[model samples]
Target: MSVVPRVANDSDPDISHVRDRGALRLIACGSVDDGKSTLIGRLLHEAQGVLDDQLAAITRESRRFGTTGEDVDFALLLDGLEAERQQGITIDVAYRFFSTARRAFVVADTPGHAQYTRNMATGASTSELAILLVDARKGLLEQTRRHAAIVALLGIRDVVLAVNKMDLVGWSPERFGEVTAAFRAFAGPLAFRSVIAIPLSARFGDNVAAASPSTPWYGGPTLLDHLETVADEIDIGRGEVLAPPRARPTVTRRFAADLVWMTDHDGLAGGRFLLKTGTTTVPAVITTIADRLDLGTLGRVPADRLGLNAIGRVHVETAVPVAIDSYAENRSTGAFILIDRTTHATAAAGLVIAWLDAARDVHAEASAVAPATRAFVKSQEPLVVWLTGLPGAGKSTIANLVEQRLVKLGHHTMLLDGDNVRQGLNADLGFDVASRAENVRRVAEVARLMTEAGLIVLVALVSPLRADRERAAGLFPPERFMEVLVEASPATCRTRDPKGLYAKAEAGRIANFTGRDQPYEPPLAPALVLPTDEIGPEIAAERLIQAILGRIRQPTASDDASI
Candidate 1:
């Protein structure tokens, strides 16, 4: 494949227009089959970014898929990967780049399915605007509202609601007005600073690149026009910028006497100074130095002996008495966080609190654990058994059985069931993609803690989606994480109806419920696949135990194995 280089010509007015213009990173979000890909492809094709070879490829795919109409199947252009082409649904955020006469654009096409909302967040987190697509025929659906709410939460300031499929709806002005009004009413209170609504048909090229004659009643500019004009500036001063540095006291008597030098100019020549600690950047000076009184031997040395990465005690005079302890004291309150002034990204994690000599000794004594004794008496291994399946699949049952077998083997274990966690630890969480991700995040964190404490952790969650499972897997080492896919047909799960959730979802009591209203993306690959419909819980547990034992028996010398 040949790489396309970015070209700019000073003589060309279009190129010159964008010479110094800032880049805009935008996310396109909507329900499945809402023509997000087509709209983006239209924008790219009209802007002359789509190469002849790539356009030919898209045409070939379109013909193969039986889209014989003169208008190209623009969706084929973005469904580039083989898996995405076959699936007919975007499971991941597809990034595409294109430039206009006024500005450059980096577009993130995110999945509209509720199951992949987390993926949408990953795209929108860094976006300046969210282009939310609304199918003109379907109006504003549940997923549309969900995406809007997510865009607001991610701090995106600009939103463009492209009401697409106008050709299918005969480009009705009243329909466009109604849908646009409903969406604006729902999104008005969100964090977005501006919202622009446009009527367009991504497939028919209406209101995308050029003003569509079909929608003569519509007065606003096309989608591309809005994108080209939307301001790309962002305010990043909402959060704290810098954190305080950690401080520690010196144990040497000479350093104690150097306290005077902390504020005095004559005591030390090249000692390091910090303007602020934590949020307070108060100016301080070394004032007093007290010599070591307990030293049995007498020695004279300059205070310059304080070397690189060395800790020392010095009395400091500040413009004000800043409340700060040695970094060795408290890791949280004493810690300082650093942010990059340019990109606004967190650059470094810092510790601010420090401890004095006597306090350091006491802290060391209190916090130190007898590792050798603990290892000898009750050494334990930590592992996470991640169970994933459809909603009513028998994950919890198998998890219970596995816990019993591990307990019988004299291993410390804990079960983190989805329902139990939803009631307690993840009570504040919802069923949306963001909430689901947060739920999994909490579970993964708890599992990590349990593993560190030398306990086996079993997580019985429907998990449903592969991205969530992958995020959980990333939290632990490969050897420590066992992804067990409890396979059962969606039909079987609805039939099982262990908790009547499926019934409630089918009755419309719940909106965007997985397996009914939302999609359940299965695990692409898993360490184990237990046929929940075919096997009993006991047999499943036995199989899992055997697999665990086999893994343990493998020639791995240590548990902290890196993958």
Candidate 2:
């Protein structure tokens, strides 16, 4: 384990790689000088997992600068850097792939140095199980507590406390219990799924890959045995335990996340940054940093800002809403890092727990034009001229003529007829009541767009339902939405039907036919009521234009329920 390893596994399988089995992501992390490299290297070496070429290289490297002078430096297998070898400590995360007979494992060996805490956070972000190593002689260090807090903060419910170098402490079960109890008391509130303690001498291979007869009283599966069979562990973390797959969340988007501030710059409520959540990167800003948790004291205090290594629940706003699963459900996409746009530095890391407010973020995704631009362009107020009536009521004919007159007068306009729009924009919509309501909704949104472009949009629709019409009207400003009802008795419309729609509806070819099988609710407070049976389309068009001009040019007190 060198780098952060993502785990994927569904269920345990037989102790042979002959068949496809689940895999687990195990990350070895603890305080600096906690023997994280030796433990990982020891596990691989004892299992005879290294290739001959890799083993030859490690043997050569160990002779050059061995941690235990001329002795096998298992740490050399992971510490690839010359500086790391000279210092006898891991600097970078070592990522490697290894497998047992029954189950495969993706291991991450992370640095234990205090300055590299951010590195450790990266490693454990996607890990299903964390191996928090402790020096048997030294017991748990401050870094141990810090790593535990981070594991909990990242929402990894499964934990394993590896008491390394048990040989140094004379293999005292009492000492192991003492350290385990101390950590349990401190980590009880962190809400891990389970925390199992294991005693091992990584240097001597006590209980890492195989059991030791020296500790006969200790009766449990060895490290390798537990990896093969850990109950309740599944492939849900990454969904493919064979290899570390990129984290993908299903359906859910928008998140309330807990972040670990890693940059030197202090956080501000409105500062914008780029967020990296699995394969997706998006623009984001911190809405607020409510409190900072002191890892040493484990206390929450008021906070306006976060310095380096500060853990806080930051309210985040994204430019585009993303589909994400909860961190508890899928750790892959749920974890994220904040990047500084200017410097490309990692500013923070976060885990999403829930979805939150989206109105501001939605507005942020599109450009909002000032009313001056669109409304002032044509020297006329941009509006939706809603032409609502039953089938064959001359709504489209009058609406088309009104648009032609407005266009001829140098006023920009767009005519949206119900039949024409249904053929394209709403082709999937049926004549069901719900679909009809949605049809009106889509038309209203289009009209709103036209108004934003400073064009008078004449929407000729059956809009038979009063509630649907009202819903469409509410999308625009009261001064900008004018309702025109084209009235005619069903019998009179049937006789004068230009398209013969009433004939087809009457023949029972159309099922949910409005004004026949379905209901037609007339507008109660229309700006104008044009009786198409009494007046011709040309006269109706002229009257509709005059009614709209009065409202667009200068709405007067005399303009009441009828024009």
- In the range 209-237, model 2's lDDT, one tens digit per residue, is 88887688788768877877775354333
Q: Please list the Cα RMSD from the true structure of every candidate, rounded to 1 decimal place.
A: 24.2, 20.0
| Model 1 lDDT tens row, 220-310 | 8888888898876632222233332233322211112112111112333212133333344422223333222111111223343222211
Model 2 spans > 4 angstroms off: 1-21, 231-255, 358-563
- Overall lDDT per candidate, in order of appearance: 0.64, 0.76
Candidate 2 contains a number of clashing pairs equal to 16
- Give the local distance difference test score of model 2: 0.76
RMSD of 1: 24.2
**TM-score for all predictions?**
0.42, 0.60
What root-mean-square deviation over C-alphas does model 2 reach?
20.0
